[model samples]
Target: MMAQPLLCEVLIDPERAKGLSLQQWDLLIRQARHADLLARLAYLLEGQSGVPTAAQRHLDSAWTFAQRQAQSVRYEVASIQKALSDLGIPVVLLKGAAYIMAGLPAAPGRLLSDIDILVPKPCLERVENGLLLYGWRTTHHDEYDQTYYRQWMHEIPPMKHGVRGTVIDVHHAILPPTARLKPDSSKMLVAAVALAAEPGVCVFSPVDMVLHSATHLFHEGELEHGLRDLVDLDALLRHFGDQSGFWEQLVERAVALDLVRPLYYALRYTAQMVATPIPPFVVKALDKLGRPSALISSLMDCLFARALRPSHVSCDSQWTALARWMLYIRSHYLRMPFHLLFPHLIRKAVKKRQGSGSLTEPIVVKE
Candidate 1:
């Protein structure tokens, strides 16, 4: 009988028979080799034996840039944190960037594109204004977009410094379009502990951070390098492995927040990817969500396609069809009240054309 193929083999990209001379490309392949990320690394590097070259190149550059940008961002973020501190706006860094910035050894060399920070809603304008004073400018500024952000979304616009060229995403809430789930950003914030050295900036409580990363993966339909996200899940679980009550609290919080679905998907994927030991009770709770195994398998095939990079969407029609349907479902869930959902959606469609769309505009931010 044939043995099962290694997970690494099933996950990695096939090797390139040619064009290995590019230093950046060679370095990536070599690092992936050392890091055991080779399959996905090679998959990303080789351009069309059937895949698109430009997309391959773009993703490659992003990967390389992410490594180079890491050291610089730590200092830059520290400076920004100081500036926010002066203004009394508390800032919390999110995800991989947060992990790296906290001086965690294994994290520094990994790829990260942006720094995510969360500030209180009341201080949203102050944070933006503070960053602007420091020579960071908002990239996607339109009155309509501003109105949408100010009135509806969970955060203000993303800011990019002209000189540094690194983008900082400032968020006030973890999940937007509030009706879809109730994982409270406030609870997350309250649980946030200060990074030991980077005292000014905070990180999500381990469970919240892991949950957020998982939600981002599953919610986006796991469309990018599936391996990269799997790596993130692995890292988070490994980091938080010894924490007592981590799993139990995660489920209780998800149940209270109505975000059990993504939590289930996250646990299932993590269990599959890294063999994390989820309790049988947790497994049974997930099973009650009704054949998630089959549902996610179907969703993976129909609702998603892994493009190495964002611009790889060569066909507008195909991209739009998938995006539109996803947005429709997302918006429908965002509207908890079915009776008002359609009219709200129509209003949103009009506002979107007028460039005033946002997921949480109608819900007021309470102190």
Candidate 2:
């Protein structure tokens, strides 16, 4: 086994990587790639003399690949904008697309698997029809699956372009209609900022952008890329934290949007795991917004700490799987009431056991 420093710590101070052997560097690269941070790692190591020549080559290759992929994603976004322009719908870019369009620090060296956009619920049908007319087709064809997405889910069924095979997720809201936290999607749309570079594209406001990222990371059952998501949070904080009054506005916006808890968790974990620089007074103010009790927080700390690490075999432990499962259950519970959740879980389990292809599970594409 190779001795490894914490990846986040190494990213913060690449000089600390001076003494790592080629084999250890190989391990680090593999772990970083698995966590979808390879290109970001490459970006951080640029111009650093401490990295081995061979390792530097690998990082450069990763960086090249990321740049090419980002370019392709931009093309796709342009096509989507054209597809929806006739409808005159306000297309709000979400997640990776938003990061790229806004030219955030989180954008460069970030690998995007698919594009995500949001439109008003009333305009969803028109947007969907326009996409299909422009050669995009629903990845899910089953009636049950289609109904499930339309009735309960926040987004329409995933669609892929017929010729290019590029996937896209079109969301009408950030959370499911059945979710416990009913964030006002209209307000989010109203507050969105237009991208100067992209005429038809808009992105969430600075504060809402962070809130949505936190909500996506914490609310989802998947932990495979939790650490990468944390890295994104760290980058967003470091980049935006520089502006005067940013922290206060973030806290205030979170409160206005009823997203204080997710912001609290985002701050707590990023500070704990990656040493993200959060202000003392900001933390103090958010602490008053009803953080989880000490016992629950401690338990969450253990689960998240284990789950957020790279999912490499060398890092695996018996407790990690249990922690992931617990968080998975907790995520669904948070999203839906027990009455709806129990039946949903049972149906999913039965479908998995039966090996049915009719109902495909939602795929979380990284970017």
- Candidate that scores best on TM-score: 2
Clashing pairs in 1: 12-39, 13-39, 48-51, 152-360, 152-361
**TM-scores, each model vs. reference:** 0.67, 0.93
lDDT of 2 by residue, 245-323 (tens): 8899999988887788889989998887777999999999988984889999889988988888777765667788998
Q: For each of the candidates, give the backbone clash count.
A: 5, 2
lDDT tens digits, residue span 1-367, model 1: 1121232233332344244445534444443433334433433344446434543564455455555566667777787876687765458888767777765422633555567888877788788888888878987766766765655566677788777676788888876654566667777777787877666678877777777776666554324344466566766766675688877777776776567777776676656544556778868876685244676556643443322112122212345356546734554555345664566567667867896557323412111
lDDT of 1 at 8: 28
Where is model 1 poorest over a 10-residue stretch in terms of lDDT? 306-315
> lDDT of model 2 at residue 211?
88
In angstroms, how far off is 198's CA in candidate 1?
1.9
List where candidate 1 sits over 4 angstroms from the true fold.
1-66, 103-109, 225-227, 273-279, 289-367
Best by lDDT: 2
